[model samples]
Target: MVKLSLCAIVKDEEACIGRCLDSVKEVVDEIVILDTGSRDRTVEIARDYGAQIEHYQWNDDFAAARNAALQYVTGDWVLVLDADEILHPEIVPQLQEAIASDRHLAINLVRQEIGAKQSPYSLVSRLFRPLPGIQFSRPYHALIDDSVTEFMAQQPDRWDIGYLSSVAIVHDGYRPEAIAARDKLSRIRKAMERYLSEHPDDAYTCSKLGALYVQNGEIEAGLKLLRKGLKQEKHLDRLLRYELHYHAGIALSKQQKVGKAKSHYEAAIALNILPALKIGAYNNLGNLYMQTGDLTGAIAAYERVWQIDPNLPIAHFNLGLALKEKGKLNEAIAAYHHAIELDPTYAEAYQNIAVILLKNGKVFESLDHFRKAIALYERRDSPAGSELRSTLKEMGFKI
Candidate 1:
């Protein structure tokens, strides 16, 4: 059996360290943690799992902390994770097999970002051999890609990079509540801004920092940085390039530059990347098409979204709207039903269905759906609930 080691750098992560360790304790042969000034029981929790802990100074550098953790790893392979992430149980066997392979030096694991509605899945190169030349880079959002690339170039025939399609890690650090608690946005922005000043041409940093600017409502600055990143297009990998274009599309759409936004969306979709990663671009493009009265294009994009991930309620709901606009009442109702099946509390889906039913003379069925929608809306304290009640009452409908 191939021995695997878990490496992590944490500070004040007492709340989630135990959960992270628990998920991988059975699979990993050794646990190594580098603590950078934790005032809580984070080190104590890690010790309970028999982790080899090392104390390091807080330098505000994620890559430095991660590399420090690698020093204590003695296993044949290393699996890097954060305190807020858990190794998915289903990927245990897959992970073991991948690391055991002779041809693979590193594997890109799929990570599901919890609470992220726009882009939930991402690829992270967190599994690799602890080679001398392979270390992490970037001050924030640190990754080993740069070092791995260098190492691969130095020894071209040594090993190749591999990927696992199934989600290997579930990360909750991006959740709204988690972000608020940690104030991650402000910290990340400071780190990236400082790094970008020193390395302005760095496409990866540009892409990330640009997106952060857009999220912070600094659209002009975000577009400027994203465009700067695009100027170095030849140096970017498929993933970085896709992100740049996707983010540019978002920033442009916010400015109401529809033509430019569509172009960027198309560029992102045309990239040689995973279809799952293109869901945001496809969905946004569909919305633009819908706004421009392009029913065919809207329907096609929404259908593509459905094909990529049928479990998404929003995809089904969006398709229903496009179908409704196209005057396909039956098809629209069916799509809305699919949305409701996926999410029972989807008030908009119920209300839309009710409207269609009422238009078709199915008064009783419409009333039932409307009541369900109103109850759900009221639960969320939405004004739509009272508005619908008033409209129904004005129509002489008895409750």
Candidate 2:
């Protein structure tokens, strides 16, 4: 069996560092952590796990940090993991077996992006032989160096790089809400500053920079950058174009450029089958129509979301609201019910259904759902629950 070295670079990751180590502690022969100036007890916690810790200075380059971490690998193979990622228990055995095989030089594992989708999935190279000359590339979206490809090309007999379906890194990297978006924006800001400085005329860089701007709440700047990027790229990257168009629509709608936003949304939908992007585009279009007092158009857009993905709770819930505003009480109730079925834990859907029932003079049914929603929200201490409780009492609810 090939010995595995689990390598990671971290800084001030005390909150999630332990969980990350615990998941793969038993699977690897050695754990190496490269800390870049952590003010927190990130180093102390890592040391408690028996991890060999090394310190590196922050260089504003992810590849530099990653390569620094790689230098400590004493095992035959290296498994790259982040401080917020964990290998699922079922995936551990598969990774062990894959590395043991002489036929395989690398394994591409799935990195599930949580909360982005009802169920999200993405793949990346996470395991590889730590042989001489194998290095990582790219400063921001760091990719494995071309050396691995060149090695395989020369060997010709090396037909062994494979994707492991059973192996996945359960990424909690985007969870708990407080830091996920903030961290992403922070990194984007750094990357943008570097990328723009080096490649001023690069359209892709501009587009990504624009996305970061939008994410950071600079909507006007984001729109300008994205439009400039779009002009340069034309229609080369359809999915990216779709994304830019969608965000442009959102920013425009927020700026009250409703007509321009509508055109962008329509263009995005007319293009292709990027499910997440399409869903977002349609959902935003529905919102735009609702704001313009076009309840019928809003309902139409939302219904398209249902046609695309029936189990999506947000689309169903929003569709129900649009229908309710149009006075289609029966259909609205049905949509709400469907939303509830898709996500029984969804408090907002339950509350909305209760409101619809109360409006229709079904006070008893409304009271029951309101109580249930309150209970659900209380369990999580959601701020939305407090308002729900207030509304329930106003409708003559006992508690």
TM-score of 1: 0.92
Error of 1 at 298 (Å): 1.1
Instruction: List model 1 lDDT by residue over 95-214, tens digit each.
Output: 888888998989999998887866778899999999898899988999999999998998899889998888899999998889999899999999999999899889899999999999
Runs of candidate 2 with Cα error greater than 4 angstroms are: 1-4, 26-29, 39-41, 47-50, 74-77, 90-110, 115-167, 175-177, 180-188, 231-246, 256-345, 374-398
Model 1, residue 379: what's the lDDT? Answer: 97
C-alpha lDDT of all candidate models, in order? 0.93, 0.79
Per-residue CA lDDT of model 2 for 266-333, tens digit only, reads: 98888854354477788889999999999989999999888877767878899999999999889888
Cα RMSD for predicted model 1? 2.2
Residue 317 local lDDT, model 2: 91
TM-score of each: 0.92, 0.71
